[model samples]
Target chain A: MTRVFAPLACLAMALFAAAPAVVANAPAEATMGLVQRIFYYHVPSAMLMFVSAVVCGTASAAYLFRRSAAADRLASAAGELVVVFGLIVLATGPLWARKAWGVWWDWDARLTSSLLLWLMFAAYLLVRRYGGPGSEKLAGAMALFGMANVPFVYVSVNYWRTLHPKTSVIMTLEPGMRSAFWFCVSAFALLYALLLALRLRLEERRAEAEALFLALDE
Target chain B: MRVAWAILRKDAAVEMRSREIVYTTVFFAASCVLVFAFALVREGRAMPDAAAAILWIAVAFSGTLGLGRTFERERYTDTLRALMLAPSDRPAVYVGKLLGMLVLLAIVEAALLPLIALFFAAPITASPLWLAALLAAGTLGFASVGTLFAAMLVRARSRDVLLPVLLYPITIPVIIAGVRGTAAILQPVPDEAMARFWAALLVFFDVVFVTLSLWTFEPLMTEQ
Candidate 1:
């Protein structure tokens, strides 16, 4: 894992550096003009946010049932990434909505669920931080519950009607925009992977230090 | 099944003896209504759909209080560990705890409903059956997750604060459904179909959450 980290970091940086050029050269959207370009960043972060949530929930389940320390660390790392990517999606979203929807925000299905998902993961991190001893299990339960909640939240809020574009918008993108969008997505995915690896390593080192301290006390 | 029944009976007996949780939780819920009434009322009239929102808000708030106290009793007596060690199924204990929570919240809502109707001029009798179904399903969904999280938090530090922090975001769907379903029924021209739709959604939420809670309760409650 350590050996691959440096090269992965370089590749992610390179992709990220090249992403802006690709996005700029992509054909201007027919209607929304330059503001539509936010889609290149916002949609990718949104996709990765959901992906991070699944990773955290799966790892948390593994930790709970298998009692694997490595799984617990991975869950912690993924949980934090969910919040990070969620922030990017959220911040970039309102900027686009301001131009497109004539309002900074709306309580539509996707917007509401995205905010709630972000809050749930934020709460997950909070429990792990302030819950003291035995908090890991509590945090794991939180992740599992948070993951299970996504659909209910979506369905309930969706009753109010949605203004967010259908996800099919991606599949139907113009040729130039399609390539640019996928380019941005791959860059974001690589960044997500790099961050998860680094965070997991940090958790591993912290656990080691704690164990060593306990041994010294004995 | 018998294990669940016995635990429920035990909780009932304890509450029957003291009536502490019931009396306090109901009063707290009523107070919540009054507070909302003051904020939402204008020219001696409540805001539109204020009754439904207030009713569910009171339920959620007092439900949090009730959940915290119920587990606080077990933690205070150090009996949760004993219950976990008993020769019975773990999910049964979870069901028992969840049933107890539902009962407590039911009493709170029973007292809450008429007060909200009178205060806000909601037509509570317009559709009694749908109202009850919505309340029942919503309460079940909320309490199912609440019971599990509250029980797990029993040993954690600062549990009082942590309970709501962890419980609210997950249970927001229940509150949304409850408030919207009740609002549909309370409207001048009631929309029975909309009410039914929200009620069905609440049932689905209850089914998913209850099953998830039952499955996870054993492992979460196991002290490592």
Candidate 2:
């Protein structure tokens, strides 16, 4: 597993290196200027956060239905990645918000939802860690709810009427800005894959060790 | 339906004999209201303006306390495992527990309402019937998911700590609707339409969560 992940990790690092260069070279927005560059990191991390949530939720559902150890491992791996990418979003968000909204934090719907979603997944990890014997099933249950909550959280902005940018605004970005955003998104996607693969391998090894211990007991 | 009633009856009998959960939950909620009043006084915010937020926070905290103790009742006798092994459907257990919690929370809220009105200077009786309906729907949603997680965490380490951590995030929508609805109803001039909208949101959440919890209860309860 390390052998496979080592090269992928190296590739992820290379992509991360290239991402900043692309962002720096891309034309800045007229109004926000240099600080607007944070969007490249912010939007992609948010994208990966959603993608990781779906992966975790799907794997959790699979675990519940099939009771497969592999699925549990995959869910656990993605659950951690959800936290990782969520931190990136949370961090980059405020940095951009300070520039754009002139406040470090706004109780805007999208921002609040992202923070809540992050906390929900964080609780999943806590349960898996501290819940003891039945933690896996408990965490799986949490993932299902977390998955179900994604849409409500997204729609809550519309329901409440908030200052956050709408999805349409993201789609309407200028051509150069859009390509730079996608490039950063692609880089983050590769980074997510590498991190998930590494984490899944760790889970697999831990399972094998536990199995071996039980076998020795026998 | 009979199975669920039987379970509810059993819980009721036990509660009548001990009166343990009711007394404690009511007192805790009272203290919560007092704390909110005192804290808000220090901040000099109008207590009536925060009435909705205070009421729901009390319910969330006190409801969590009741859920933990309710399941703790089963844990003491090892009845939870027996219930799991029984031939009857597991969702019945969900229903029974949910109903019992609904009653317990209602009692706590009954005590809480007057205290909130007195301390916060809010007119809770302005639209009593609508407020009651909103509270009912909100409690149903809270208890539906709360009972499921409380049971799931029965033997878990540090469940007392973990229950609120796990519960509040998922149930935010319920609390949000409850607070908003209550706020609208308690206003100087109540907006019937706003109250109805929040009520509908609570109902939708209750239906979705209750149905989902019912389907997932068995698989999660099973050791296999």
Interface RMSD of each: 0.5, 1.1
Candidate 1 CAPRI-style tier: high
**TM-score of predicted chain B versus true chain B for each candidate:** 0.99, 0.96
User: Against the true structure, what is every candidate's RMSD?
Assistant: 1.1, 1.6
Assess the local accuracy of residue B91 in candidate 2 as a C-alpha lDDT between 0 and 100.
Answer: 90
Q: Where does candidate 1 clash, by residue pair?
A: none
What is the per-residue lDDT of model 1 for residues B14-127, given as tens digits with 9 covering 90 to 100? Answer: 999999999999999999999999999999998888999999999999999999999999999999999999899999999999889988988898999899988899999999
Tens-digit lDDT string for candidate 1 (A49-137): 99999999999999999999999999999999999999999999999999999999999999999999999999999999999999999
TM-score (chain B) for model 1?
Answer: 0.99
- How much DockQ does model 2 earn? 0.73
Identify the runs in model 1 with alpha carbons over 4 angstroms from their true place.
Answer: none
* Candidate 2 Cα deviation (angstroms), residue A41: 0.3
- Candidate 2, TM-score vs. the true structure? 0.97
**Residue A128 error, candidate 1, Å:** 0.4
